[model samples]
Target: MKDIEQYLRQNKPETPDEGQFIIETNARLSNVEGIKGTVDAERHRGRLMLVIALVAGLVIGCLFTLFVVFFPVPSIETELSAFSKAIVSLKEWEALLLVPVAACAIALGVFLMNRKKEVL
Candidate 1:
């Protein structure tokens, strides 16, 4: 590399601005290519992250929907009508109770699965 630099300096044409122009053009080209490569790498990384996040969200959404459909929490209604009095009543805090219970259930399942796999 040093030898190449020395040869270029010694054998470069005698035109006044030509060597300066060549050096500047090479510097600009280097900067442009570097910036383009950096941007492309960043774009690829962002796309991968977006795909992973989307997949995670979809899995969580599916699980939540299944939970709601299968393990329905009871609801309490105070409205009284001749047609409604026959319906059974449930406690008001049933939904709230299920929320924490489901959360703990999922956490426990995850913890047990990880433990079985020798993961923290």
Candidate 2:
């Protein structure tokens, strides 16, 4: 132990700090903090936009589904049967499109909501 201490004392290296080291460090930290704050603000804005998009997609999907399913327009046979025929033709694919859109909205919402925290 004495020999180890003696060797350590004899071979100790000197590390010198510059006179403005603290000031420079603080300045760099301040700049980093500014950047961090900007990053956080942008992250929050992006999250909000994602949430809005998800909600809007879900709402639009729901309204569209409801309109397609429940809302019926009464008309006479003398009216435009051709337009009604076109709509009836599209009814088969409506569910196919709606299910995927709703799924995408829910998937995006869940992915965004469950995002991992990167910086603590």
Q: Of the candidates shown, which would achieve the greatest lDDT relative to the real structure?
A: 2
Candidate 1's displacement at residue 34, Å, is: 0.9
Worst 10 residues of 1 by lDDT: 84-93
Specify the highest-TM-score model's number: 2
Q: Give stretches of model 1 more than 4 Å off.
A: 1-18, 74-120
* Full-model lDDT for every candidate: 0.57, 0.67
lDDT of 2 by residue, 57-120 (tens): 7777676656655644444334647577447634645665666577666767655654533232
Pairs of residues clashing in candidate 1: none
* Candidate 2 overall lDDT versus native: 0.67
All candidates: CA RMSD (Å): 13.8, 9.2
Q: CA shift at 86, candidate 2, in angstroms? A: 14
Per-model TM-score, in order, reads 0.43, 0.55
